[model samples]
Target: MKQKSENQKAFPRFLGILVVASLIGGVLGGLSGVAGYFWEDHTAFGAAFAHLLGAASPWAMAACAAVLLGLGLYQYRKSDTAFHGWDGEDEDVMQRAEERLSWALLLDSLTVIVSFFFFNAGTAKLPQSSDGNTITLLVIFLVVIALATLLQQKTVDLTKKMNPEKRGSVYDMKFQERWWESCDEAERRQIGQASYKAYVTVSRFCPYCWGVLLLGNMVFHYGILPSAVVLVIWAVLSVSYTREAIRLGRRGQKTE
Candidate 1:
């Protein structure tokens, strides 16, 4: 009989394909937006873009762009370090979590692209701080970062899954084992503490990373959309991803 584990199971495989498609679609759509954004001065399209970002000044876009990018980098570092705590048995769960995250990242990329096209027309003809090329380039940079991080996470997931014993951390196994054995008051407290810390670490950094992502989309959408909107979206996505990680973490708790 064929091994079920070795088989390319439908859901994960399907999700993987969808993720790739979404990323491709978003990149293409974003390019169109860049073209339209720089299409011409005093055109109807330019006027509309100004209306979308909610700021007529291009300098506003520039400022937010810098902030978003800076925050994105910081969040990336934090996320990178957060997962180092998980060990061998937790590897499969983490891999699945990361695979799901990859799909979400791709969807976000596509959303950013679609938002750009939605605001293709009707922004200010003249940018406040920099030229259209500069702003468009910044948007591209955001896309690059999103793509890179997702790829890195996915690769790490695959590597861990492939060599769980060799690369695995002993601490993760001991933590899980101990947590499972004693469900007593002190143990409960330790479990709660570990769960909370893990959740917060993942939840905080993941959303910031995703927030920076949405900010890119917002930039495409509003030209200078409110920072409030960006934060709001960040909160929503963070909650969603957090719920997912918690569910996985709990499952891991049970299995061990």
Candidate 2:
């Protein structure tokens, strides 16, 4: 009973973190877009693109913020209901709700990171040519998207292994139900905790890194440090956080 109570408390705290992160991300992203528009060289096609994004940044971020806030509210309401009405009968529903919440966090975090990148690049004064740099940027964008997709697929595969019934196949449901029936409560809780930790760790990583970068950029503008130095720091932090994410993913895999 005490353990269950602790878990309940942990979830709300997590949701609170999610809400705060989302709000911060939206604001920062919008600010970045505006700054980029003003700072970038206007002659290049990239600059024109950035300027257009700057014009739209605030509205785009506002929409994202609304969605994130809505998700947070929905999670809070669901948590309240689960707290008061939870019974063994609704375990599956509770599990699904948690999974959905995790996915929401992941999506929100990615949105923020992408917005930050737009702002970062938009603010930079790239070469005025519509040549190699543009091609390189496009290739990098595609690679990033591909990597994100692969990671998402890996996460989904891990989830399927953890809960076969989660795939919505009737055969898998029956098989997994029987399999899970044989597992002890401790084992089940271990898997759940691992999965939850993995999701939360990944979701928090990007915002934290971007937040640092944003702060560093602010400091740099005051001439307290070189932009190159700030970029180095951002690079180091990003690599470290990425490594941590990989470690968390591996830990989740161990549960399977």
lDDT (Cα, tens digit) per residue for candidate 1, span 1-256: 3576657566698899789967876785676567546554336765565554544333443444345434443443443443555564666655554544444444434444443432332133335544555466456545644554454445444435543532422235464454355355674677668767765776566545554545455334544354465566667767876787799899999999
Off by more than 4 A, model 1: 1-83, 107-256
lDDT of 2 at 244: 78
Question: Tens digits of per-residue lDDT for model 2 on 149-218?
Answer: 4444444444455455444222353745654665668868886688667656655565565566665454
What TM-score does candidate 1 reach? 0.25
Query: What's model 2's TM-score?
Result: 0.32
